[model samples]
Target: MKYNRLLCAGIAVSLLWVSPCPILSNEQNTSYASPAPAKGRAYYEERGDIVWEVPTHRKLIALTFDDGPDVSNTPAILDLLRKYDAKATFFVVGSRVEKLPHLVKREREEGHEIGNHTFLHSSFQHISRNKALSELDQGQASIVQATGAGTHLFRPPGGSYNDSLVKLAKEKGLKIILWSWHQDTLDWRKPGVHRIANKVLRNARNGDIVLMHDFVHHSTQTVEALKIILPELKKRGYSFVTVSELLSNREKPDGLIEVNK
Candidate 1:
């Protein structure tokens, strides 16, 4: 299938109407670093409670979609995953899960994993600790309510987190899940389909937890990008699996490569 170039061009222009959200800036591209003050992936990696990428020798990668269950984009993504016989993890916003429980249910039925993205997609850096806990609690609750299953994974909105937030996730038995730094597609910015696809194709590696979004406003760059990413990756002998599965196959420290960043 071909990317709709004209449609993407129009969406690129419409991107100007979108408000700024939590996105890592160019300056913050340090190997395992996050934006200022927030604990980088390495800090959590030392604690062994957060996962940016699994360390495994197998050609396995976990494709994760965040801020989703959107009517416009999610189903199309699910369709592509099904077409490629690939499994993915979706970090869903709680509010959207409540509104579109059916889509969440469909994700579960199709052998995909669901993780909590927070009740309102609020950044922990901006909210009080209590409010952040509530966001986590409610987000987890909504997923259980929608699918009768709870998630063990939690992704801080915009990849923003601190020491306390990481501790809190541990207290709740949720592992903080971040994306491989190189695998971020920036699809939320309405980058063209080729850019999005190339981001994944060029940087893809074993145990990569790819970051993509399904809740982009007035955009379908992600869905179109996957049209190229999935088949191409599969041809390269990469097997897509859920994050948990990737973790289960993690290599021992002796065999581990320092590529999770």
Candidate 2:
């Protein structure tokens, strides 16, 4: 499962149109505060009914797409998933779902799971408790309107969460779903397609919840990367499932809590 770093570097050099820096990265000379230490799966689980990756031995991976139901990308992504018989969970924006309800409907109709990504995709870390509740409620309402069903999963915008936000999510009967740390493709940054494909292929493992995006502000890197990722992973005997399906295989805890890498 090792990636060829030389090949990836060469591809990046050749793809001159691709940005040399990530879009989300701070500009040069900008002084930003250092980030906090990364939290493990246990940190989230202990805080609330949150899950990053399930502990399991089966070759099951949950592919989750956030910030979507995009007109240009989502349908194509769905087609590719269908081609490989892979099911994914899409955490769609409530506003987008209201406008493009058909796309959300297509996702559910194709056996993919849909989760709320909030009405305005607001970060709960900065908003008030009442605002957070409104985001959750409105987001759920949009999903139910589109698919005629409510979702039990929610992923805060940018993975921001705190004690109050988690409690609010719990009160709404939503489990906060995050991705396995290593499986984030960063496709939203519009990195070269090979890089995105390699990130997932190289780090993929059992019980992984892979984070990808179906909407990326006029970029199709995720869709293009999937063109390579899906078949290659299928060859490796990995079975793609919805987040709910993967969660069903979670191992029961027996006193000691083992940290997931």
Question: For this target, which candidate reaches the highest lDDT against the unseen true structure?
Answer: 1
lDDT of 2 by residue, 21-47 (tens): 745343332221112314554776765
Q: Report the number of clashing residue pairs per model.
A: 0, 0
How much is the lDDT of residue 131 in candidate 2? 73
lDDT of 2: 0.85
| Cα shift from native, residue 258, model 1 (Å) | 16
TM-score of each: 0.83, 0.81
Q: List pairs with backbone clashes in candidate 2.
A: none
**Candidate 2: worst-modelled 10 consecutive residues by lDDT:** 28-37
Off by over 4 Å in 1: 1-34, 38-40, 256-261
Clashing pairs in 1: none
Assess the local accuracy of residue 51 in candidate 1 as a C-alpha lDDT between 0 and 100: 81
* Cα error of candidate 1 at position 145, Å: 1.0
